[model samples]
Target: MDAPPDIHSLLAVLDRDEWFSSCASDLKLALVRDARLLRCLAGEAVYRDGESARHALFCVVEGAVRFSSALHDGSPSLLVYLEPCHWFGDISLIDGSPYIRDAIADVDSQILCIPMQSFTQWLDQNPKHWRDIARLSTNKLRVAYQVIGEPGALHHRLARRLWLMAHGFGSRMQNPSLQLSVSQEHLAQMMGSTRQSINAALARLEGLGLLVQGYRSIELCNLENLVNHANRLGGE
Candidate 1:
């Protein structure tokens, strides 16, 4: 795995990230100066549910991260997969509430963290920046709504979810294939089904030449075929 990026590289990342690109010049510069980079290995927990959200905010600069939430008994389920340019934990920083989900690196990841105090002070100075955060949240809600439209046949639902995962989450691979850095159990939770069901769906997809499953990861072998299958279900 790579080491944390230097301040200069991280500053460029902040500038390019959709979540912060529209910030006022002063706020943007302050974020860059106050931020630090952290490198997380695969499967490392960036933050856990119910923990005090004291680590400020994390903007993914490389690789991917997954968010999950659990019941009272501690059984967890997938919430979302975040890619580079996406962020997590901002709500905790704003509302002083503990995070509702866990953030874990799906692969070796480089993250830029801004301390809560710095982020808060900058936002205070630029109250207009609040709109950007709101926009991000609204977009997420919109996507969630689209994804949750009346559940249907298992293969259709599984195909829809896989398509979303492949395109919604960014990757560094040169080929169009997407490597989901998650297991079948986690995917089962995301799909709201049992592991057996997910396994069956995966086997069907592989048999149809749409995917290639690996140990702890999955790759889409036929993007067009998957997209066609997903589009047959619903629009994103």
Candidate 2:
């Protein structure tokens, strides 16, 4: 296996993307000024539900993190999986409230933790970057709305999610396939469906020749067909 990347090196990678780099620079200047970087092993909880949201927003420099909220009985329902260049804790960071959700490392992860006070101070000092923050916030809201409004069908929801992930992360890969290493249980939680429903949908998609499922990898076999199906579902 390849060696893991350091936090500073991860920051450099985020810096290569114009929008991500600018926001990261502002966040880094505010919080991680001289702070030591931390590492979280796979399956570790970055922040548990109901914990004080004291830390600044966490940027996924490398590896993946899953943001989830507890069900009535305290079982976690995965909301989404975030990878490199994605930031979380925005709601708590903005509202100064305890984190409403729990964040866990899905793999060996490197993240930058900026203090909340420092982030607010930097925002106060530089008003221009706030526009970028606003855009990011708006985009997040749009996604939430789309996901929330989706139909109850598990395959429909999964197809939409795969499309979004492919559009977001596929450019870096040679084939641009959405090969998320997530389990069916996690997918069911994210989609607010049961494991049976998720499995059925995956099977249906495989039958339709739109996806290829291996042990832990799912490849988008036909992007156009997937997009068309997503659009038709959205229109319904």
Q: Which stretches of candidate 2 lie over 4 Å from their true place?
A: 1-8, 16-18, 21-36, 168-177, 234-236
- Candidate 1 residue spans exceeding 4 A from truth: 1-5, 11-27, 41-43, 72-74, 106-108, 169-177, 222-224, 233-236
Best by TM-score: 2
**Model 2 lDDT tens row, 1-236:** 12434556565666543345556465545544633445889988888889998775776777888988888987778888877666667778767789877789998987767667767777889877667767556667877787777763567768888776665432222334456667788888887878898899999888888888887568888778986776665532
Pairs that clash in candidate 2: none
> Where does the lowest 10-residue lDDT sum fall in candidate 2?
168-177
RMSD of each: 4.3, 4.3
Tens-place lDDT per residue, model 1, 6-58, is 76666676555544665666666666566767789998988888988765677
State, as a TM-score between 0 and 1, how close model 1 is to the true structure: 0.78
